[model samples]
Target: MFSSHSKLYRHASPGVQEELLALTSRLRSVITAQGVVRRTTAAIERSQWLAPAEWSALQLEAMRALALHAGRRVPYYREMFARLGIDPRRWRSLDDLTEIPVLTKDEVIAAGERLLAEGGPWLRFKGSTSGTTGRAMAGWRDRASIAFEQAFVERQARWAGYRRGERRAWLRGDPVVPSRQADGTLWRMNRAENMLMLSSYHLTPQNGAGYIEALEKFDPVMIQAYPSSVGYLARWLEEHDRNYRGKSLRGIVTSSETLGEAERRIIARRFGCPVFDWYGAFERVAAIGTCEHGHYHVMEDYGRVEFETNGDGTANLIATGFGNRVMPFLRYRADDRVVLADPGFACPCGRSFRVVERVLGRVDDAIRTPDGRHVVMLDWIFSGLFGLVEAQVVQERLDEVCIRIVAGPEFGHREEQALLLRARDRLGAQVIVRIERVAQIARTRNGKFRQIVSRLSGSNETDV
Candidate 1:
């Protein structure tokens, strides 16, 4: 279980703050000593060396068990199977799963009450999405599912060379400090997690040095943050002719936002450490993490992922989670696009799991064509072109889009025509695509760079 400082601590006196910190540290130590961490570590050690066939067998067995439980215990799935004329008990292999219909976020939002099992041995908690796609939805997760998710995260941390109980710093969306507090401490100590929770909203140019100083004093062995948050600091240091290298940092782990090649290089150079990118969603349907060799490998045991080919060499990801039996997500559509690599491709890290070529942003990042098609990854329009430092695609309306670019010396009319032609070819001839050259693209309030911003607000009716 996770622990947080009480609200009373916010109003406590200076002496009480220290006392609270001490109490938090003690609580964290107790939680760490519990069997959760130990079991997770053991699972990671065993699964990493499993042969390909052995891993597949284990996953299939888990899938069959989950399907049986859902059909027997869960109200929604039991009724769904009956309505679709499917018998979960008769399912012999993974291929038989196609008889069931896919689940969507809209269905989860509309019929969540029917999704939960009547009673179980596990405890349940309510969780909400970040609403980055403009639609916020809530779901439930059982304690066992939560523990397993934490284990997978711990396994990823180990891949990044971080050990449990080591000091670390976090720069994410958590509001550790009040946004209005302009002059005081911008961070709080989560002594239980041994974490220095830094505020992502306070990373301004004037406060960059203060943040750097605090991190240096804390001497955290690893920093887990959003790519945009760390990228901002890296840019600030470069502009000021300063550096934060030669510290206690072992590696930097990034998530939440897409990490670009340029931003990765900048962060690695300034921090003197490798940057590992992790991709996952709150729905817990699928997860992909960067390996030591910088290739993304799907955690095959965590979830089952199926790709829906889009004929453009990209596919939408549909996943079924092995965890979270409280709200079983069967053939859930994630709406995220990815390019899958050959199944025979093997990582030098000796893992036999499948690899993903790239995660092309989310479906919400797509521009809608007049014929009702969503054109995703329009940023590729500027790919391989010189003199383009950064680009953003804004879909303000159904028929029009604005391409914002931060161009360098070599950018010219020829490059502009190329971008326009590429967009037009994907969006069709009637759509109006315009290019707007700018000094720099803007980031979100949480310091995230969104490649595609769609102003349209409505339900996503795309088929899985």
Candidate 2:
């Protein structure tokens, strides 16, 4: 019933392992609540008294729990805590978190071997991420850590109008293709719900039509996808004067990448459904997400986020996963930046989670010029090029950039020329700009399509 090439067997065979994982997940989904209301009520309760002070307190408590567990079981953390003169019991606040040094991608890569060698108590499994600067790193996640992740995921789904067993389509980091059985019959696994996996990488005009048709056929109550992919589809529909009026879609969920206001508005206008933007990273699992009222709300009660500055006002994001245990990421630099929203902006929806005005782009997405100058305002270039359905900018060298665009037939050459000229005009005369026409652009393994790719190395600093 399974294909020999399928990786579903890595953990266990297709039939048994898939069933067990689904059963366990379903149990977990209901373990906290009989339905979405009960689960959402708990979250609402947590957010009600969730002042900044409470956020600090929870982060400290979470760190203490992690340190205690690590001191007893994980070798690296045990030695590190000992060297820092920290008693697992004495560590009790966010200030104590300051005492613990920050964890970086490089440290994670090096400690991997030690983690594997010890093997018995440590959770050592490979988890890949395109690090803060688009560099790939494969790290380990413990079983305890994974459970914490599952909880956050379930919570997010509930927040966005999803029930435990509700039918929904997940357009995530993986490809959206048909799964087939040994007899070549389309293999469909129904886990008390409906989920159609769509590949974000292949969001071509043709494939997009198929996607729209699939959404209608599956009749999922929700559609979830990366901001770029959703925005691309929105732009396509808008350019063609088409409507993706999927009758069953309650809304569209955009996550993993920064979703600009323009893209959000366009998506909502074309899709005829609400667009919810989620801000999260692989390291922290859950951070901030948009509510129905279209504001980015912080999950402060669940975790803590800190900005590590370079003294000149530039900062790197460091997040502590308050809920995870198997691999509690303590003060791990996320490499994403944000501008904290003022406390006064409250949505009428009454969700207690505070909102952020916007999430700035990733640190790795920035471009540096040859004369030691930096291009900080990415939105400026993006806003300047308005007519594009899809676009990407790759900086191959200090003075060279390759701009790729997938413009509709209605999009005249003059508009495309203007986009190239505007990008070149933004970078000035010294930078060589090459505009290339592409049928498709590449995305990361997790399906994040970066609008800008910077290969210009050596200048690693980013100002938030």
Candidate 3:
């Protein structure tokens, strides 16, 4: 669903808005109802029972098809293949994929439209990456690929005992409720999916009680949210000597940010359910989902994943998605790291998917407020921002936030003001936002870019 911050949704009466959302959900469900998502989900469910040889066979087939498609239709891959004197169409095994150089973010941007398939429907789905590294790239996928990924998401929810149309609550980045809703109704009902959409941006200590009350009343069978947003609710519960009393709640599914152990334990304990952490990126190359046995299983069926040793006790994620063909992501390297399990390690759940100890994904620090509200996911301020190569938020003090930006060609005073206004919407008027122009944002010692940096040393901010 699009953001509720839009003027059309903002002015509608609550009942009318609910009806509109349900209508939107109805239109969207046509993609899944008696359609591609259902068939794909059923096929993947069967794939889980496949032997290692069977799984590899299916993967190789998908890989081979993608290779041939890219070689013929995509100018970028075709030229690269010609330059290397390699014919992907004649390739035999997965090793051949390695012969093609790994694709980097910069290469994708430089190549631009040359990477898209030659036919029509050039870019039905397109969006900007969060650019946590400050080099946000435009990404595109075919409609079929988007529906295929949804099946996998549905399968993950089913792992947590979710059923279609079951009541669920979302506390992720969706701005279902306006940031400045004075009434403290921080949620909206979407009857089409029987979901309660909660606003992550407006969650603060002052309105924590109302959010919890709304959630309890909804009594969702599953709670899908970002770790940061849900962490705030969990900490608020513990601090106030309370626990979530949703009898119907099955489990909490968290994504986007890394789920810290401290946050996970408290969230599970206070919410009276296990916390299932999921990992996926805007690039749609790699995927990791938590299983019934609490093991982090690489979703091998979703995409082909490889680990490049980072030499710091972790490995970088390199993947090639099998679903997308409009812009095939063959050997795309991501800025994420994961901890692999010991060799021969297996899960009790009877799945043969390779297991990982954990994903050391984004560990962005939250920006603390003067009024005790620690605002996480400040990168949302840069969402859809153009003329900006990179951006970082640095908190020097509780009351002031400095936005450091690497300006793009279109970045100017107006763009900076838009950035400031977005920050103010989340940080509130009490906090001062200052934009600082920089030639480039420096990466950490390990050559990793951080979206947010807090100079408050040894800050013992609460569990949230």
The residue pairs in collision within model 3 are: none
Query: Taking the tens digit of each residue's C-alpha lDDT, what string does model 3 give over 46-129?
Result: 987677778777778888888888989999999988898877666677777788889988898888889888895644777777
Models 1 onward score TM values of 0.74, 0.65, 0.94
Model 1: residues >4 Å from true position, as ranges? 1-37, 130-132, 363-464
lDDT of 2 at 242: 90
What is the clash count for each candidate, in the order shown? 0, 4, 0
Which stretch of 10 consecutive residues in model 2 shows the poorest summed lDDT?
A: 178-187
Candidate 3, residue 88: Cα displacement in angstroms equals 2.5
Instruction: Report the C-alpha lDDT of model 2 over 1-464, residue by residue, as the tens digit.
Output: 22211355324544554464355446544543344444544664576456667666665776677667766667667778789886857765566567778888667656754432233434344555543333334545554445555555566666677776677876654412222211121122335445655544345455556666666678777777877666767887887889886776777887766677888899888878888777776666347777777777777765766766546444456777665454555677766666666567767777656666777645336455544334433333433233444667778798888877765564578876766666665565667888787787776764556656776665432332
Instruction: Mark the regions of model 3 whose C-alpha exceeds 4 Å error after superposition.
Output: 30-34, 120-123, 457-464
Give each prediction's root-mean-square deviation over alpha carbons: 13.4, 13.1, 2.5
lDDT of each: 0.73, 0.60, 0.82
lDDT of 3: 0.82
Task: Identify the superior model by lDDT, candidate 1 or candidate 2.
Answer: 1
lDDT of 2: 0.60
Model 1 global lDDT (CA atoms, 0 to 1): 0.73
